[model samples]
Target: MKAGRFEQAQRQHIATLVRLGEGREALAGREIIQRSWRRCVDDYRLDPSRPRPVRVLTHEALVDSREPVDELLYVARAGVDQLFAQVAPMGYVLLLTDRHGVTVDFRGHPDQDAALRRAGLYLGADWDERHAGTCAVGTCIHEARALTCHQREHFDATHIALTCTAAPIHDPQGRPIAVLDISALQSPRGLESQSFGLPLVTLYARMIEDAYFLHRYRDTTILRFDTTRAFVHFNGRGLLAFDPQGRVLAANGEGRALIDAHAQRTPPAPTQVTQLFEAELDDLLALPRCEPDQLRALRLRASGEIRFAALVEPRGVRSRQRDAAATDAVTDIATGATTASHDPVATTSTPDLDRLAGDDPAMQRLLGLARRLCRQPLNVLIRGETGTGKEVLARALHASGDRAEGPFIAVNCAAIPESLIESELFGYLPGAFTGGNPKGMRGLIPQADGGTLFLDEIGDMPLTLQSRLLRVLAEQEVMPLGAERPVKVALRVVTATHRDLAALIAEGRFREDLYYRLNGAELVLPPLRERADRRYLIQRLFAALAAEQDGAVQLRADALHALLDAPWPGNVRQLKSALAFALATREGETVTVHDLPESCRAGLVSAPPLASTSATSEAARVRRESDDALADPEGLALARTLAQASWNVSQVARQLGISRPTLYRRMRRHGLIPPNRREALRG
Candidate 1:
């Protein structure tokens, strides 16, 4: 084979660009053109000084050719094929060229086949720099940079109808391996040609670079950064890079958003790549790094603004000294125990309490209060609707308390049989009752001696047991049946009840004195219906449960809407059960509306309109139903009196012909408890 006049000219042009730079940049340009040139030069085994001989680089030649030049050309052609197929719907063509800029593969619309072939724009077409100067494929290859040329940008008048963008794809060593070009018919009025064509070309080039890097350097970390390191090019979401000194270096788009929210302020720059390197250095130097079994995320205040970050030290470097110190600090912070030394783990591995995963203000406040309250041994009383997770709050309290290492005994007072309630709580002595143990057993109160005792449905306890419970709580001791002496116990008591204790007291069903003792420190857990955090709860529940289940079972948009609209009489418990049921019923991938249980689906359906003859009749019908659902005589009297009395409970009670206690009880029953007072009602 021999080289043509155009091929000789292109080689000269590429050689000129290589002389203008030095080292990596210069080498990069030379490698790109040399790889492309080798495809033709080696395939025909020709000298460039001779006249050019043409041959199409088929996929078979690429796969079967033992030569590296043939393999590279084969890969380039394959990539061009894929790019053309991907963007074919947008009416674009993909072209691949040799180092001398001759078209090796031209992929595009079949409708333009005749026109393109006639214009010498098909495979084996001569597009060397000499023949097509300043064009996308030729100029980008000649300049060793990405270029976009549209319509009249072509030096050859015959190529005026095309808008093309070409980017030089580089290998891991920063050598240009091939040029990726996307060309479309010139669109004089639309922006799609420029926007889609240019971006698509850039993307294809990046994909090639990424694939090459991953293949060549499998062991080394290949961190891909955008112009700024604000968004890393990989799939990991919200990844934030931290320095050894605990400074934030760079954050991905999602990570930046989280950091901004935590900090409650925006960063000065949109993206800063240098910050990432600096932070990496600081992170590496902070302490002896160790890989964590699970990466604990941390959010801290920097420059008076909070930012989210994670410490990811490689595995096997964590020493016992580091682990002990870190564990001690975390335990102290969580349990309100003695402060531990400022170890690296203490400083770097603390979990972000702010990111505990809920969006409701009430939930946020509850978490904040839980964090502060965890440091103490105060008895807590959580009052909420039945399915509102009284137990979850109790567990959180226990886990966050000093006695987390000790037992957490939870007893449901209402679930226990009346005859067994006393024995179950206070334990029993040998021969104290029929079938009694030979040796006296420790009761729940004693079992929870070093930790927390969660008494659920305390209001439902029989009056006889209430007095005994009050005695145990007041004396901090319990006397088992047939025991001669009381056993002293050290434990925190947390009680929950769905019933109104004051109403029980007024009915003479509960002891008033006992109520005050248990209400020492109250925390009212809001019912799901009343909680503003339903959306947050849904997200957290899905995230927590989805990982355990087999297939994809995300809530449908309609399901989420339905969940938000439904009155959750069963609260959090019902929500979890509903999701479980939906997951079980999911046919293929998604949890559709049809997968929901009848009860949930029914709840989702809008209630039917009441029959009416006239417009006024319909309005009255609607109002009547609304009142029936939300306003009884007790609620109406309370609402009216509160409105008239200027929202003062005591004044409203006096005006509403009820005692203050009676008014409060009715307000709670009617779900009229004010947001502020609801916290008070927790006790």
Candidate 2:
């Protein structure tokens, strides 16, 4: 019988008992047959067509099979021994089988083993339907499901001494793969023994299936859920639900939180999907389904919460063929949603400014200036040390500004060859050079029309091209090499340079006029050393990198401190390299200080420590005294001003003159805060 059909048959049998008013009496037979069927299927991989026969196979004939019978026998014998040694009080016989439906492996206690073998129930026996009709392993295999049998339920009269439970193991793709069975000699206690072991056998089968699936479908999304709707799956974005018709059904914890606060206040009742998004859904579904690139915001009816969602239908002839081959392969689950339009001022045209990572006041100031400049079409000059993220800041400005909808074409001036710089920048006509394309090319400036053009390493731009670049900026037109006509270009230029352009101009290496043109609104980025939050950078880098490595590694406390104290000459780039190297060499959970590269290790050891114990103790005392004296408002203001001026007596005197002495007296009178002259302060 087929597995599905067997289940149907069992259900029918149970219904008949209930209808006959013998439901309670039928339980015994039901349990017995279920256990016996499962055991026969699991033990011999059999089917109903070839059920166990009336006569049992002799031990010698069973052992004579050349098929992988010895391995099965060994495991069965071992299992039986273990059952007797540990579960002897329970008293159960272990049964095993080969890939085929044959009882190649079996075991029992020494006393029971001898008696069972003599009774034609021991090793080398074939319990398949061919030999014993409607048996455990054989029938279950045929049904491709679990089964059980109870005492007196044997197909053959010679098999009256046993009861069994069995289950079939499936491969990752749900094919009936293997069988496991357990049997016990008949006892006066009835079918309870087989019933008790049914779930255990079933659980083992499930474990094997799970492992197989995990391996086979490694790329597919896997979801795990707890009783109360918590997500326990790995690499999951969020919990989501979809109706049979593919409508948004529900969302997980984090998704619900993202809805507008007002929307969350009046959420829909349980099992109710918000109707507010009906119009939006209709519009989305109405749009041409040919291309799925366009995504729109979905707003909830009850809570006014909004989410971004896109529909993706399989594309291409190949995809259709694959879909036909595996109709059930694709799951129509709602993948996830991100917050939509949270800030009215922020738009798609606005560059993703917030992507830049830093908390320094200088960086904040630069960002503020970038935001303001984004609204106007003005040239921007980004000045910073190499690897200090100048280009990142420039991209942010473009993304946050009004022209964000325009293209962002970035060209590294230093990387391009000097000879090709002009052609590359201004483009060329067909056959403009020896190997140039016959068709004229659009220059970078023309290509960047109606968008932002980022010129990185602008300082390295050859002096000859500087004048031509200035002309383009001045005229808003680019004349391609060998092209007769000048192309009118509208572009916003954002240039970055590590070298001091003003210094270069003074040295006659850069054009003075071009420098002024590119420096329309200069934003200088401070180096990592100037940022006080080195500790924050270390922690962020470590956490971000560790997440990328999955569970491969982590950094120890000492290693993190070493990272913080070391002067990052290469800034973030150097830090990332060191972390990556350390993680690669790490043997266990944590990366020790010694795991760092030789350069980083040397830098950490060579650097002067932040503050010695004695210095910290003294500084602490000074802070206490300062805090005590600044209790009064007037005294506090004066103390702050003095501290701001670094407590320089001459500068203090110049600001507060004859009153300086008197202010000094007053400060003493008010317990003036003393300054620590040891540490230098940057203005």
Candidate 3:
């Protein structure tokens, strides 16, 4: 907006272009930036000197962009808040953008909101390479990695005053869904100033991505590991989601990289857990029986290097069905069913509690317990992440229980004001207060007499009110504000919250006794991302949506894949809303990728590799590449070490800090030694 700044920017842009055209060798060091600059000018046809105003989307459009990643936002909320808290003091702002490079969420000091908004660091601003030219978020989107686009690296001179660091958050399938960035309008000069911030941005980005991965695969068998055993359970860098037979379904970015490290060549990703580690399915399944702190030692298949791994078994399955196999005892198993001696429930399908319990293993287990305990006179506490349908679970429990005929009153302790919560929950006698109802009103507890009382967000209730609620739950009696006698009520209380009640108790914000009183039986509902039955639920919800419209809105494969890849932070509720939105806006009969809302499209890769050539060509190409690498300094040192060690594989492996298998693979790749020479060395 300032004339002087614009003039300065134009000069810098012109000078930078001239310097780039001069074929300066130093430009090689900034190849990534220079390549992006060329793409901006040649491909996108962007003019750096003619700086454009920040493109901000309308509120509705912003919400549409935010919709698909609502689940990712939920998973990332804690990370974003904590990151902002650390950077806000230094005048830095945080921006989380969808894969399209539009900022969906942001945090900055209130005092600087206006300035930040104008700088395009606020929500709804498009930072796509084509829209805003070279920037951290946009470049990160293109590169599919993390980097710092310092002030001068920004294409538009208008953005030269801002230095931003950003990293991409990829889904489990390696498709990017979002970008996490931290930027400052003004920072200390020189690139070294970013040393502290780049790692922080990239770290949180990976953390959020890994958290989302875990959330999506929570109900399956997950094998997590790290180089060292100590930190494997507490935020391990490698995550591999496998099936009961030890086949890898998916892996996080770090996990994939770790697997690739053991391979001599890269063609297809690893398909089995055994390809990377020498561990069997039985070993993996039995890891859950070990102490939580005691991690199992997993050795790399190639080098035999040790990696500490922890197994996350499927939650809440009583008689878990690992695999299906036909035995002689159960001949002609197709005709009826016969139980095997080694494995039971081999022929029968898993039991379902009710319609509300989808095929998710965790949900099935929890609901099974709830179904069995419904007739019992016991209070229940449900714990789950936000948007996990805790209230729905409580309602299901009530409907299936002996109290189904009685009234079921659901209350959100967080929705009511602290001042009114007392009267609203406990009721008040006439004239108890100046504004009291003349006829006297019964509280929520009394209204649920001979039934169920569902208290949602119970963690937010005021500390003072927790005591009274606890008393009601313990005594099955309620005392009105101004009544002479207490009222007796037979109601089962169920409470749920996204917060950690134990943490709250330590903070002295929640009553300890009240937690136990309501926690007669604990049930946790997994978030949608973590649910094993997402595919089933998605189809069921879409079919229901179609029935609601009473028309066929066909979903194409592209559009459906987009839906499946979504972060789904809001769980079942969010998925239904997205399907509905796509169905309503789609043209003709079929829904294509373009028909989905912007948020839903965040996980869709622009143009993916459709096919690959023969393995022979790939192997040849890798051989050639390795042949060239042998001329490098690293190769020369390795060769010298091999000669010094008399070509002993183990000795060379130990000296090179690699496993013998890896060393052999590398040697074979480079065509280093012949079989005769290797045999002579062994002799």
Top candidate on TM-score is 3
Best by lDDT: 3
Q: Candidate 1 residues 1-683, lDDT tens each?
A: 12374345445544442332221222243344444434333343333333222233355443232232232343343456678788778777777655555564568678899766654456655555544444677667767877676654444434545677888766543455667777766546433448666677877776655544443333222222222322233422344444334444444344455445544544553233233333444343442222322222222333332222223332112222343345455454433211122221122223233333255767655665565456466777788888677766776677656687887777878778899889878998888988777786678788888888888888889999999998998899999998899999988888899898889999999999888877767777777877777886675555444434432446778777676766777677667656554453344467665544334544423455434456444343433332232323344344434544545777777776789888767765544434244234222
Candidate 1's error at 479, in angstroms? 0.9
Worst 10 residues of 3 by lDDT: 336-345
**Residue 141, candidate 1: C-alpha displacement in angstroms:** 60
Off by over 4 Å in 3: 1-6, 18-28, 265-269, 289-292, 317-683
**Model 1 CA lDDT for position 432:** 91
- The candidate with the higher lDDT, 2 or 3, is 3
Better of 1 and 3 by lDDT: 3
| Residue 357 lDDT in candidate 3 | 53
lDDT of 3 by residue, 1-683 (tens): 36697577668775775455454423458777888888787788786657886799999899789777765776687788899999888878999999999998888878888878888988899999997988999999998888899887888877877889999999887789999999998775887888888889988998998988876786688888889867788788989899877788888997878767765554355688877888777777777532367888888877778888887665323212221121221233212111111211122121223545567778766765676467668889999987676766776677666677777677778777889888878788988888889888788778778888888899999988988888887787999889889999988988899999999999999998999888988998888877877776666556555544444667789877877777776566556555654554344577676544444554432334223555444433433343343334344345445645656779878887999889978766544452244234323
Count of residue pairs whose backbone atoms collide, per candidate: 15, 40, 2
lDDT of residue 659 for candidate 1: 92
Write the number of the candidate with greater lDDT, choosing between 1 and 2.
Answer: 1
For all predicted structures, in order, the TM-scores are: 0.42, 0.39, 0.52
Superposed by TM-score, candidate 2 places the C-alpha of residue 666 at a distance from the truth, in angstroms, of 71
